[model samples]
Target: MHFELRDYQFLKVKQYLKQKFLLFSNGASQTSTNWLAVEQSLSKSNLKYYKVYNKIALKVLTNSVYNNIKQAIKGTFFFLKLDGNTNLLTKQQLFKKLKSVFFTLLSIKLNNKIYSIVQIKKIKSLNYRSNMSIFYQFLSANLKCVYGITYKKISKQCDLNT
Candidate 1:
C-alpha cells in the first residue's frame, strides 16, 4: 500500500505548504526496494524529501528514541501503578503523565543530527504528519482508557479508576 502525506486527515493545506521537506519511510516490514518507487515519484514532484543516507546511523537513532520512550512509559506506568491498578490514577492524570514523559524525552538532545524537540513540536503544531501508528498502538495497549474516549471527555471523567 502506498502512503501519501496529503491523504492524512490531520494535515491541512496551510500546514502542508509550510513544510520545507517531507520524511518518508515504507515501514520496517518493507524492503528498501519499495522506497525506490516513492523516491522516483518524489523526484518528479516539487516537494523535497528527507533521505537517510546512513542506514546504520538512522537505525541507531530510531532505536534509541524508541527505547527511551518505551522505558519512560514503563516507568510512568510502574510509578502510577497503572499496570496493576489502572484506577489508581484518573484518565486525565494518566494522560498528563504520559504526555509529560513523551515531551520530556523528546526535549533531550540525542545527538547533533536529530531535530530538537522544539522543532518537532513546532512541526506537530503545524499539523505536519509523522507515522504515529506504532506509538499510538503502544499507548493503547498500555492504557485501556485511551482507546474509546476523546481527550476533552477524558479530562472530565475518571474513567481509568472506573
Candidate 2:
C-alpha cells in the first residue's frame, strides 16, 4: 500500500504536467527524487517552466549560495560597479561580472552544510543524440518568481497568501 501510494503520487505529478505546462508542485519539498525522475522521463518532451519563492526564502538562498555574507555583498557591489547599466561606469571599474557569476556558483551552504555544484560534461546514454529538454525543465522549474510574477501571463489571479 505504501509503495502504491508513492507511485500514485509520481503519476499524479506527471499527469498534472501533461495537462499544464507547469505544475504547482505542492509536494516539491517532500518529493525531491520524484522531480529528478520526472525530469528524466520528460526529457523527450520540450517544455518551459518556472517556480516562485518568497522573500525570506530568497534571502536564505542568497546566504546559501554565498556562505560568507560579507563576501557576497562585496561580490555584489563589485559586479554592479563593473557591469551596472550606467554610461559613467566603465569596464575597468572592477572584476568582470560574467566571470564572477559563473565562478561563484561552485558551492552553496544550507543549515551549516556546504554543497558543491557538480558539472557533468555528458550523460551516458544508449543513443549519441543529446536530449536537453530535461535540462530546460529543471532550470525553469527552479526559477524564483519576483513579486508573484512567475512568467508573462494574461491572467493575474494568483493568491500569494499560501
Candidate 3:
C-alpha cells in the first residue's frame, strides 16, 4: 500500500515543527473525552500539543499481481530471453540474490544529513507468521537506526511479540 501526501499537508507539518508544537492524536477520531482534556491541559501549559487527524487510503494488491508488476518493471524476464534455461540458478541461489537485491533497494544512505520521522500504526493487523511480517520487522529496525521511527499497535487485545 502507498500513500501520497499533498504539498499543502507537507507545508502544514513544516509549520507545526517550526512552531515547536507537540502533535498528538488517537488515530482519525478525537471522541475520547480523556484525551481531549489532556490536550486542553497541555494547551494551558508552556508546552502545547496540537491534535492531528490523519486520513489514509490504501491500495492492496495480491502477491501474484504485485510480483508480475515488479518482475516486469525490473526486467527479470530478460534472463529467460538471453538463455532458455530458467534453472541456471538453484532456488536457494535465486532466493539469496532476490534477498540481496531487496536489501540493497531498501538500504538507507547515512551520508544524507536529512532524516525522516516515520510512524507505523496497526502493525498487529499483519499476519505474524508471514515473510512480509519479518520483512517489516527488518525494515522497522533499519529505519530506526537512521531515522526517527515509531511502531504502535493501538489495540490492546493483541501482543506485539506475537
Top lDDT model: 1
Reference-based TM-score, model 3: 0.22
How do the candidates rank by lDDT, highest first?
A: 1, 2, 3
Give the Cα error of residue 35 in candidate 1, in Å: 6.6
Assess each prediction's global lDDT (C-alpha) against the native. Answer: 0.34, 0.31, 0.31
Order of candidate numbers by TM-score, starting with the best: 3, 1, 2
Error of 3 at 159 (Å): 69
* Top-scoring candidate (TM-score): 3
Model 2 lDDT tens row, 1-162: 457854554454333323311212111232567656544433322222222233322344354433343332321111111112222322222113223222232232222333333321133321112335665666676664542364544244344433
Deviation of model 3 at 138, angstroms: 39
- Can you list the residue pairs that collide in candidate 2? none
Q: How far does residue 41 in candidate 3 sit from its true spot (Å)?
A: 1.1
lDDT of 1 by residue, 15-46 (tens): 32233332222222224686565445433332
In candidate 3 the C-alpha lDDT for residue 102 amounts to 26
- TM, every model: 0.19, 0.17, 0.22
RMSD of 2: 25.2
lDDT string for model 3 (8-69, tens) is 55445444433211222222233578556544543333233332223210111122222222
Candidate 3 runs further than 4 Å off: 1-6, 19-30, 52-162
